[model samples]
Structure formats: structure tokens, C-alpha cells
Target: MMDIDVPGHIEKVAELEGHDDRAWCVAWNPTKPVLASCSADKTVRLYHFSKTDADTENPSVTFVHNTTISTGHTKTVRSIAWAPSGTTFATGSFDSNIGIWEQESSDEDDEMHGEGVKTGEWECMSLLEGHETECKCVAYSTSGTLLASCSRDKTVWVWEVHPDADFECMGVMMEHSQDVKCVAWHPTEEILASASYDDTIKLYIDDPSEDWFCFTTLTGHTSTVWSLAFSPNGRYLASSSDDCTIRIWERIEQHKWECVKVIEGQHERSIYSLSWGVGKRRGDDGKGEFGGWLASTGGDGKINIYEIYEPPSSSDPKGREPPTHTLIATLPSAHGVHDINHVSWCPRQGYEDLFATAGDDGIVRVWRINLNGQ
Candidate 1:
């Protein structure tokens, strides 16, 4: 394989093992030092990590297996997502059900199960069933008041989260012509986006008097769109496709988005997953004017990281220039020939450089980007 030289080195930190089948997705808790992964093994694994010297430049971190949730799904647990509050999480399964899970409040069972299990028993608080086929992805809105799930049934369902694990179906959106692969919520808005095998993406919003409706459709990908992610600032969106390309879209106007960039020559095979994070670098004001880092991985077993940045004021006086990206690092054969199914950056504020990937090898690997040979 040909190597693409880059500035940073991605070093593997830990290999979390437990899943008996292919691991499909990994998500980091928004408020805690926990990471969650789902698998075809019909289980969810949680890992907790801590920093030894948190205040120093080089901190030693250790990851311990927290617990295993034997989600009572009949098929593969395809996707998992954490609520922004970190108090609850949702799981999507090929059995066509979405499970809402929460930890029991009583600290009675603090004993280890076998080798790694620890603290707080989790329970399936709610089970959502409506999809006619496999549920592909699940995501929570920024405020944790809403949850969105898409399925092979070609429909996107939005649910209103309520107290005591009660959930009400808000709307069922049927805008895709084929299997819906992924669903993502806008960073700071109520808007939702879904990608499909129809090679298109549809955006939806609540119409207040009329309920949720499709407002716009994004078209440009020539093949199945596998995943979708919104930028941290919510001004832009990124998508990966089976065509082996990534497309960047800019919200040019209210209720309108246009494709501004197509990233090619990165992955040679289908791109399964991508994530955007508030990276360590910032622009002039120390705010995140420089956009952030975009990480993608898929069938080729490679992990690619890119820095997305906006042009300086002098270069674009009217500020009309769309953000651009450059590949800063690449790790080939990330799973040693097994396809990497998902990549997610740690959502916590101080751990932007950290990320985890789930692979067909049934292992969840943690990695950190070492910049400037640090």
C-alpha cells in the first residue's frame, strides 16, 4: 500500500475487547469519562477512563471496562448514541427496535461481574418499535429533549423524550425512496438530517402547526450516502458515501444548503463513517473560528483526519468563502484488514485529540493524535 505522509502521528492507546461479533458504533458520553460501543454481538460495552496527571502536559490515561449490557435485541445492535446530558442513551438494532437505557440510581451492586464489569446496573427504560425493517442509526437532539432514528424502512422517526423514560412519537418522516442509513441532528438547532441508499439527504424541521416536514433535499452524491455529521458551529455539514468521497455542504441561507466542496482521493473504498469535533486549534480570537477537525474511516481500514478552516478576513472581505480542509494525518490498515465501521471523537472539551474506532475485528481501539512529534 502507498503511504500518504502527513504532519501528525496517530498512536493507538488501548484496545478494548469484549464484543463477540463485529463492533458497529462507538460514542463518547457528553458529560462523563465514559465511552459506549454497540456490536453485532447484540450487546453494548461501556468503558471508563481517567487521567493520572490531569493538570500536566503529558497525562497518563487508563481505560477500564465498566460493564456489558446484554441488550435484548434479536439481531445486531447496529448503532448507539448518548444523550447530551449523559444521563441516558439509545440503541438501534437490526431487530427493528430502538431501546432507551438508563442507569439505576441505587448504588447497591458495586461488585465486579467477571473481570471488568463495575458500578451501576443499566436497564432498558423504553423500547420503541415501529420500523418495518432494521433500524440503522439513532441520535439525540442537542437539548436531549428529542431523539431521531432512521431505518431500512426508509422512514425517519422523531420522538419526544419525557420524564420517567416515557416517549411519545412526534413524527414519522417518509422522504427517502430507499433504505435510510443514518440520522444526525444539527449541533444547536432542532433540525434533523438523514442519508439514504437513494444517494440523497433530506433535511426536516418542525412546522409548528403542521408537525415535522421535509424542508429541503440535498443531492449530489452519485452513490449511497452512508453517514452524516454537522459541524460544531452548525454552519456546515459533512457526508460520506459508498462512492468513496466526502462532500461538504454550507448553509448558504435559511432553509437552504449547497455543496461547496467534494473531498476525493482519500479512501479507496466505501466510506462508512465520519465525525466532526472542536479541535485543539482555534483562530485569532481563541474561539473556534477555524472550524474543526474531520475524521473519517471505512472499508479501506484507514483513518483520515483533516483540518477544516475558514479563510482569513483579508482573503475574503465579504466572508463568503466556504471553509476548506486539508488532510493532516492518515493511519492505514487501522484494523489490520478488517473494515472500520465507525469513528468518533471524544466529545468532552479537553479531549478533542482523542478518538475511538469500532471495527469488524470486534475490538474498539482508542487513539490520540500526536502533533509536531509531541
Candidate 2:
């Protein structure tokens, strides 16, 4: 029941309805106008949006139901991730399998929607089966050359993407003693990070011999780590946990990371998801010297947004200061008494302030930051 009319707050702009069961995750297409959401209903829905009045202060965005894939998974589809090419995506399901999806036809065969927006039918191109239990999360590398998946089986798998929709398993990491909750890749590197029920985060890198191995283990959270996100610059990482806190880790040296800051007293329950985006704000020189915005939501049925500022210039000879963050906005009961399972910023450049959240209400809600409160 929080008032969203205040300045510098986040406003709910659209509610997308289709899934008959709880929606678990949402992902934005990196190169298209499409947004994808997966649900416990064992389906994946795609929505396309277009913006009007791009130069105006109050731009309008219209979202249309693009299509829905039956997803063939026997159980709930837990997570989805889009490739950098936007031509393909991957889904991890509770059925203990991963599905690689792609359009059945090329763009020339796509159907046209409002304003000539293109839409296509997608099909599962490959099915990867290895996880012993539910596949909790999936993510593609920045270059789309590798894909990472973690599961309740307590293992992380790395796959090499081939041209004809083929995936070759490169490694299987069993570093976590309990269920792995999420997996994320660094924005500009091949480094892969995974959070787990073991209350730890592990980072992996490809060795010179072409084998992927755990390089470091990060520990600080007192409870299960639920999610992980890297700053836009990839120099820092943020992790949310069942401890109801977020920890920021900075890369201090080559292959070394240290916890520099801990964010607390923001959420009343476990933090399920968080995302970092290149925000609209800039530094004094009118350049993007500062960092981005971080959005988080969880079992408390609330959404919080924080503005992350770059560490100030310091005279310390050893290193610079750690980044600082301020809570900018929050919305309670974002889904009307339903827990939000995921939040993701739109990856497309011009729409950085827009983000989408999936909730236990079986709805995907789109929101925008109103810095001017208009």
C-alpha cells in the first residue's frame, strides 16, 4: 500500500497476464523489442513493446502479446535467459532439463504487428539433460559463446554454443555442498559466478588447458545466497541472500575479490532477485562517470531501487574507495500480496530505466523510474 506518487519513485506502467501459475523469472532480449517470462505453468510468454515520443519527458511504451511457447517441459519452467544475438534463448526447468529455443523461420517470415513490429514462432531446438534435480538458473556469457546452468543437484555446468544449435558440455563443477540457486556471468569477461544454499558464492574461469575450474570462493552471507549481479563495469559484484542483506564485492586484484560493503535493513525477508543497469544519471561533467541503479525484490512482496554511485576519488596509494549506494525508491505490495520472484532491467540501451518483474500472482509487471515524478 505504499504511495507511488512521490518524486524519484518507480511507477507501475503495465501488467502482462497469460500464465495460469506463478511466474518465476523474466528476461529482456538484448537486441529486440521482446521480453520473455517463464512460469510454473510450464510456458514461456513473449511480449513486444514500442516507445513513442522518445525525446519527451513522459515517453509512452505499448506492450503487445507476441506469442507463447508450450515449452514441452514436464514441470515448472524456473528461469530463462536470452542470448546476445537475440536469435535464441535458453530455459531451465524443474524437470531437470534445459531447453534451447529459436525461431522456426527467419525475420523475412515474421508476422508484422503494430508499427511493423516483427514477431516469430519459437521452437525448442535442443534439450540438455544432466541435472539430477530442478534446474534453478541459466545464463549466457556476454559474447554468447558459453552458457552456464546451476541446479538443485549442487552442480554448475558450462556449455559451449555451436552454430547449429548444438551445446557441448565443457565442465561440471561440484563446489557447492547444497542446492545452487543462481548463475551469472561477468559483463565483459568469461568469469562465471554461482550462488547457492551453502551460503557461498563461487567464481569459475577457463584454465589455459581449456578446462573450467573454480578459481575462488566468496563467503560472508549467513544464509543461503539467492541471487548475484555484477555492476555494469564488471569491476564489482552484488549478492543477495536469505540473510535479508546484500553484499558488494569489488575486484581488488587479478582473480581476487573482496567484500567492501554490506547493505542491510532494506528488506524484511529473503532477497530473491536483484539487477544492475546503466542508469540515466551522470556525473558533474555530464558524462556517465557514476555507476548505475540496482533493483531488488523478494519474499517480502516489496520492490526497492537503489542508486549506486562510483567510489569517490581518494588519495590512498593502495586503491580507490568502495562504491556507495542510496535507497532511492520503493514500492510495497508490488504484486498485491504476492512475492516477486525476479526483476530484470531492460538490456536495450535507450530503455535502461525500464524493468520487468515476475511474481507469484502469475503476472509480469513492467515499471519505470520517474526521476521527475511526473
Candidate 3:
């Protein structure tokens, strides 16, 4: 079900350099070819790339700066998440606040005076301040109803977003023993997953009592779990950790998850972030096959690519074995000795192969994976 002879290449498309301090996270807009990056500089930058400017055969693509918003957060802006509607987004900061930002319908006439500067106004609609310590990450459910945030206080808070953009504290989960690093929502469901410095991943679901509860805890990593991503189909979850391994957890049954695969020893340092996308697999038939593309970025300044093969047939006598993974490409020294903090795949409808990475070097880079003969 996989083309073993197929190979893929990562080509850098754009390099955004405006943050005065380390860039911590990068997230793509769900419905636009735009990206938002947060940094320790207490600011967030947006970049927009034109589709015609993409050159698949070249080594990189060029992106243009759209706008820069200096959020009033006194501390570092750690994470950002865009809503599915693409009209609103949220940022979690070390100031222990979650800022809700919305795009205005039109830009001011003063901002249009510059020749080559594309500018827009983003207003901070509300600031939710309940975390006792640094807020590490924030995520929105696909339906845009629930917003989840994790903090150094060892708790995850879920908020309900009202029609007028007001946020109400729905629940606070205190299941993790150590600082929570990241939170993610299932692609199509209300299921939420949080990774912690205590080396575990916890899954929470909403019960019939109108409360969120932790139903499962996945424990395998020997070090801190930095980030996590759920597969497009929502059947599997991938986690990156300080142990220099990426663990793949498959949902075997309702509320039961198991680690089915572990990628070890490839990354030279702690893996910080991972994302899943779709890419082409070339075959001898001259036609390309499409498969899942997994990318992991780490402190080693490397971005590695792995391919996930098709699932086992239901009629197989062996039943469901662990899915196989193959290393297809490696982009070594991606940030040139600086640690890459986060890498996020573009969630826009037609841009599966595009992704963005934020680094300690104060740079955010965009990349595209190209398969030959595709």
C-alpha cells in the first residue's frame, strides 16, 4: 500500500524576520494562505503568500509581510490559534492572559499610505485572565465553540465562546502533575488532548453532565511532552517529547488509546513540535500516490519527514497491526544552530504540503514538501 521507492524534498519558501526576540509559535489561518507567529518580543506578525508566487521546482518561495500587532501582554507571547471561521484568533502569553483578537472589516486610510506595506488592524476584543502562572498554549475546537488553554499552573482551562465574542470559563482540569505544555482539540470532535512536563498526555471529553472530564492518560515518554497533533481523520495522535522521540497513539476503542509506534534516536536533540499533512508518493506506474506526511522539528535545528502507509485491510488475517513509518527526507540545521520551537502545518483547504516553523533565532520560515513526478 506504500511506494517505498518514492522520495520527498523540503523547499524553503519564505523567511520572516521582524521579531526582536525568540519566536515561539507559528500557526496558519484555517481558511487563508496567511500565517500568524508569536514571539517573546511581545508581538505577533502576520504574513501572506500569493499562490502564483509559489515555485515548486525552486528551493524556496517568497512571502510578504502583512501586518504586525504589538499586543499589550507584558510578557512573552507563547502561542496562537486561529478559529475555523478565520475571522478571529487567540494568543496565550507568559503574562498569564489569553487575548482574543478579531480582524476588522476594513483598514484605516492612514495604514494605506505606505507603498509596499500591507497592513490591517486587529483589535484585542477581550483578555481572559485566570491562569495563576504563564499560559503556554491555546487552541480552539473545530466548531469554534470551545477554547482550551494550558498553563504552568498545571491546569487546563476550557472556555465557552459566546456569539458576541465573550468568553466564559467552562472548566478547569487539574489532572497533570507538572506544567502543561500544549493543548490540542480533535480535528472534528470536542475531544481535547493536553501534553505536560510530567511526561504524559491526557484526553478529556465533555460528559452529559455539561462538564469536561479527563477520561484517559497516555504515559510512555521518559521526558517532558512538548507538543501533540491529531491525525486528519482523528483516529491517531502524534506527540513529540524531550526524550527525542515521536510517539504515535492510535484510538483502539472508545476512550482507550495505545502507543503503537515510536520513532527514536533520529532526532539529535529534544523534539519540540510535530504536524501531520498529506503528500504525494511516486510509483513505478508514473502516477503518484497520496499518503500521510508527518513532520517533526527539534532543538537539533532539523526538520524530519516521515510517511505513514495506508491502514491494514479489514480482511487481513493478522488483524490490525501497528502502522509502519518510513523516513523520507531530512532538513538538517533548519534554523542554523538555533532551536526550532514549533512547526505547524497550514490548515487552509488546498495547502496541505505547506507549513511554518518558529525558531529561537527570531525567524519564522515557511516550507513546502514536493514529491518528484507529482
lDDT of each: 0.91, 0.91, 0.86
lDDT assessment of candidate 1: 0.91
lDDT tens digits, residues 1-374, model 2? 43553347788878999999999999999888889999999999999898878778678898899899999999999999999998899999999999999986656655655344344578889999999999999999999999999999999999999998999999999999999999999999999999999999999999977789999999999999999999999988999999999999988878999998999998999999999998777336532247898999999988998888876545352477678787777888899989999999998877888999999999999999887635
Residue-level lDDT of model 3, residues 261-286, one tens digit each, is: 89998798899999887654445342
The positional error of residue 257 in candidate 3, measured at the CA in angstroms, is: 0.4
Per-model TM-score, in order, reads 0.94, 0.94, 0.90
Off by over 4 Å in 1: 1-3, 108-118, 282-288, 312-319
Steric clash pairs (candidate 3)? 12-60, 13-61
**Stronger candidate by lDDT (1 vs 3):** 1
Error of 1 at 113 (Å): 23
- For model 1, how does the per-residue alpha-carbon lDDT over 1-374 read when each residue is reduced to its tens digit? 67667878788988999999999999998887899999999999999988778889888678999899999999999999999888899999999999999987655445534323236689999999999999999999999999999999999999999998899999999999999999999998999999999999999999889989999999999999999999999988999999999999988778999998899999999999999988877336532258889999999999999988864535443356767787888999999989999999998876889999999999999999888747
lDDT of 3: 0.86
